[model samples]
Target: MQQYLFFSRDISWLGFNGRVLQEAANSSAPLFERIKFLSIYSSNLDEFYRVRFPVLMALANVPKPGEEVTDHRGILNEASQLIARQLDEFGRILQEDLLPGLKRHNIHLIYKEPVPGFLTGAVTDYFYTHVLAFLQPLWLRDYSRKFFPENNKLYLLVVLTGADGAEETAIINIPSDALPRFISLPYNGTQYILFLDDVLKLNLANIFKHYTVTGSYSFKITRDAELELQDEYEGDLAEKIENQIEKRDLGLATRFLYEPGAATRTIFNLAQTLGITSSNMVQGGSYHNLKDLSSLPIGTYKELSYQSWPSVSPKDFNTGLSIFDTIKNRDVILHIPYHSYNPVLRFFNEAAIDADTEEIYVTLYRVASDSRIANALISAARNGKKVTVFVELKARFDEANNLKWSKRMKAAGVKIIYSIPGLKVHAKVALVKKKNNNRTEYFGLLATGNFNEGTARFYTDHILFTANPNLVRELEMLFIFLGYRQHADKYPALQFNHLLVAQFNLQQTFLFLIDREMQHAQRGKPAHIIIKLNNLEEKRMITKLYDASNAGVKVQLMVRSICRLIPGVPGMSENITVTRIVDRYLEHGRIFIFHNNGDTELFMGSADWMNRNIYRRIEVCFPVLDATIKQQLMEIVQLQLNDNVQAVQLNQSGENTEVTNNLPPIASQQEIYNYVKALQA
Candidate 1:
């Protein structure tokens, strides 16, 4: 076999971001969706800097960890170059494609302007009434004592000139949260969309009357988001989390973005005062914070956007019988976004009201801001049913929201479990126990995504509702372990035969499955493997996959974010191919399928192939035992494989190229919706 090493995940992640940029640049995509992609790209980059970029910065500050380590500064510098190119493409797309595309539909987004003379009156009124109240200007002469820009907030550095020719610098904060990012102007015929930046720019002198405005340049800062929780797993987690969140804005600045083509004097002066160096300074378009473009109100020209795909109820879940009764006999699997989330919600709501229900168990890593699941759990506790919830306080950006929900659940009599010091309960599972007719039964749910209803509308995930003794008993044991009923040291005795759990048997089980496929290949029988995940960076797992490829096993992967595995190399991984799909719905589910000599076994759950998932976090991967559900999942994967739209083939070169063939166009997200609808029919 040819020699190879895993690609750097940070660089591979940039390749994934490039795929998002590809959608923005694709002419086949709808105009507004293209705009939304730009927003998505910017938002993604902001997060990368907040969360991922710091690792490189830390490495840059210190020496490299190992001989095999990729150059941290080199990768970051390459990222800088990649981002520059992507931003240039973004500018061209907005200027050449989307702007003109919107104009063809009679919607105008005004960027560069000779402002219409007739609209000055409305602009003046808006400035006085809506924008002026939030404006606070700080004179920079006292810069050392009282000037700090909040993270990710847009601001303007204005060079002020007095009549005597002396000048001073002042900083003004843009209150984007208080006012709409795009304001509609009073036009008799043509629709005019103006950014709040230009509105402020046009009226800059008015806001600062004491000095003549020599120049105004826009800029924003991004700060490091990782809150180093010092003391191990001992203290008040919620308090520590809340304290960290309160200090998030004050964290060290990671990126300093300035409007490209801004005055050098203003840029240098502001950068020096803000302690920004060349490494962190990023030159952006005339406006910053364009993620707000996703919310542009174009209600009159809705036809310019892609047709919406409505969520439909699954065929197996629509029976008039109670959901509990339905799951008690046969398993029910749901494809979220394509299928209605009502059954999952009904699981909790029904449990809150069911007289036989004795307890509800849930593990929530991240939940929706206005979570119906949280409300239902609270209701269950209030209705006299015992509810034990594990709210992981260390769930990254969602820490504050989880803290709030945990407090509410705690107040309602629900038992709350905080994050373990060394681990995060990343599993998404829930169990409801019922004592009916002098028999105790368990109805359990295990999902690939969080119990967040808001995200369920746009995140592709699978949840299985089952009463199978094999799956539920193991899940019960796992829950007892989480609830302190069983000691952590006794994790080995559970003997999980049906479930593949992380930190225990998940890795070994997957390796064993690959070995089975290898044996099938050696025996000259049909053998293949299909896996999907958000990331693929586990070295040992990748090596196993390489071994499978060399053994004549056909492997296909759909890694959405970070993929370090190299595919399609002669004699190394020539039998393997990889692709990624980014569309209206995010590809969030993790699925593994092995061809067991024509009897295929399928599984789906919360774990990706990342090292953190395999060794650090609590994750679950359960089998799709029902034949019909297994077939459905197989069809879903096949459709995604056949997708000609919104799907890109990835290669060892770290490039996400569009899939082109002679077949008809099939967008997997749309096809899956139609497929589920057909099943219901």
Candidate 2:
């Protein structure tokens, strides 16, 4: 057996998904929130199949570039097995735990088979009114190239028998998007829930009355979602992306999923007609695409869900002082979800109105549909302020939204920057320049998350508002590089000493910091490092950390997903410990703390410790120069470290064990909210 030195990226991602399942199983979490966790897990898995599974399939027959093992088929087999087990566990959680738990609270989630007498008549009426209008049944035998199944769309492969004992198949498209997945019953006093699957099953005869539908199996196809933007820099970038979007739904089939106990003949027919081999088919339970559970009606059971934690406004910059003036002399930090995003909004809104504001620049990777940020940029352009916005068309799954915004902004006199040749601007940064009497003053905002206000309410992030002259000057230089100078490598003269810009300085800076810690540990001085990222899979960085662990430096990692580093391995990473925290709010924001022997050096950024972030994308990691702000970040990180309730220690085997000990319960997300609230008070 040729063993790889690190855990496979896909396997590690599965481990992260497993942690999500653990969230659903957690009894301390509220009931409806547990259901939401299941939804998150399903949604996460759906994306994995659409995005990562195709790569696995393509790599199955071909060998990788620098690999020791080229067993992609073997890897795919293992993935299918793991998913089967997880789905079984998922079914158990919904049926055994969630459903029964709902019933105990006077709510009944009618899981599988047999719609009640009252709901049958009421739900059937619902089906006739809402669902029946959109139902389209295509005879599978007559299926051709014109009728390829779209990705992630639900279907029922029916095995039929004619009056003369002939066999046939038809595909019924499930109108999940048009109708709600969970249909609420009209029964008074007791709450009853019904799945769309059961309603369709009961009413199957109403649509296909001519044929004897013997075996109808529910399934959904996941297509390869990798968009091939050929010759990106050569020609119309937006047009190329638009063309790819048209073909996305019809991409290569990577997974053929069907409900468990689907008849062998039905499976065979589906396999042959759909080009799904035995290797591609996965057996799931009654339900598919449980991600829809996100919309599950909580009714009056708001108590069954996690209590709302309203965003707290940062009180450092008073309303009396202008946002620009406050940031002109000091650095203000906003820990989002805990801290309100209003000040960040105020930054741009004020820029739009300020008479002295000369120019505004922003890089948007993903913004909300009705983005107030986009609206602000348009308002600035209309106000005669020169504005340039970079709308990255290469943001996966967000191409269409980006293009729409790009068109709207370009029409509004804002200069729009589309995708660069091979690089995606993954940096979350905004810059504003004010023309003072004698000189030009710059105000810059660097963030660890997107500028979208919608996500700020749930996704944990760090945003720094600064008027630091040196940092702003470097940022101005980088924007010039992006707008006109062209390629990343073409600009080595770009000096970002105060900022860590990827491709130019980020990787090297991180290496230098790790090596310094290792050197200090070798000399028997106090040395340690705490790194927090959404993922940690960059091979070189993992190698550097392994070497540091060998040098007796203490290393602690809080990686939420896709961690390849094997912690606690004797002689390999014995001194390194890796843990994960998944709670009410998403655990995002990347924070790097290096114990500089005494004077602690810290960094927060949009980039993860992944290959794409380190080597490919244009990313920015800014320093926490302000002591008070740095102290706030340190406190937040410490709270996460001390989280025993929703935190789990990950072992080398990829199992997440809860951090149980003789200590008071601490859920970091909830604690951070209170901590910031107290600070404001």
My TM-score estimates for the predictions, one after another, are: 0.97, 0.97
Worst 10 residues of 1 by lDDT: 485-494
lDDT (Cα, tens digit) per residue for candidate 1, span 310-398 = 78887676778899989987998899988899999999999999999999999999889999999999999999999999998989889
TM-score of 1: 0.97
Predict model 2's lDDT versus the native. Answer: 0.87
What alpha-carbon RMSD in Å does predicted model 2 have with respect to the real structure?
2.1
Error of 1 at 67 (Å): 6.5
Q: Number of backbone collisions per candidate, in order?
A: 0, 0
Q: How far is candidate 1 from the true structure (C-alpha RMSD, Å)?
A: 1.8
lDDT, each prediction:
0.87, 0.87
Error of 1 at 444 (Å): 0.8
